[model samples]
Target: MPRRKKTFLCGHQGYGQICHRCDQTRTQREKADHARAEKKQKKQEWEAAFAQDPIDLRDLPDHVVVKARSIIAGLMTNTNYRDFGGKRLRHNRFIISIPVTRNYRMLCRDCGSFLVPEEVLSHEEYNVCKPGG
Candidate 1:
């Protein structure tokens, strides 16, 4: 005796009781949906994390945000700004600029005892904010 192919309700012919083609397609769709849902949830969590940051980092690139956060954490823990290659702005001694990346900088304010992160700005934005820039 040999198995015979039969048409399922989905119009797909297969040897199984159910349409394997449709079932395979449905499983693939479910997997895709699950993946999309997970991605959405991760994005939501990432967005929510910004609220806890001392400075607004929502607009910075992902890598810049992560670097800025690490710098902020280091500053909070009494790390020397010099260690991170940070320098006080020539025009504004109270403002410190720390390089977050080649194109981004993190500015912090001198608050007597500790540095308070102000904002993360692109290289162009930082230059525009400088005197005569």
Candidate 2:
């Protein structure tokens, strides 16, 4: 094949040169900068959503401290945590009080009758009442 003439925007790749390699490098640099910016933005949003409370491990119960440490480790490694409207997690970090009589049999204050706490627990326990006949 006969040699076709090629052209260069600059004589020896100096300033103002629009070479293929330079264009690719510029594109890669732009992509990298964009990704870094996105990561930074995500970090800021996450920080805003959750404020970390610093608790002295020494002041906490040994088991509580151990569980907290494990959760921290999971967060640091980006695993083992799920968001439940920011209320609950896979682990019970907060206490959930279930309404129940102190014993299986208890006096119903309303009717003064001995009653067994319901087997199924629910918020309805708050309205527990009996007709004082």
Best by lDDT: 1
Instruction: Please report how far candidate 1 places residue 24 from its true position, in Å.
Output: 0.7
lDDT tens digits by residue: candidate 2, 68-103? 444444434643234211122123323112222221
Lowest-sum lDDT 10-residue window in model 2: 103-112
Q: If scored against the real structure, what TM-score would every candidate get? A: 0.86, 0.32
Give each model's whole-structure lDDT: 0.89, 0.38
In model 2, which runs have C-alpha deviations exceeding 4 angstroms?
1-17, 51-133
| Deviating ranges (above 4 Å) for candidate 1 | 131-133
Clash count in backbone of candidate 1? 0
Model 1: which residue pairs collide?
Answer: none
Tens-place lDDT digits, model 1, residues 19-129:
889989999999999999999999999999999999999988899999999999999999988899999988789888889999998888888999988888899997887
What value does the lDDT take at residue 119 in candidate 2? 23
What is the total number of backbone clashes in candidate 2?
Answer: 0
Candidate 2 residue-wise lDDT at 127: 32
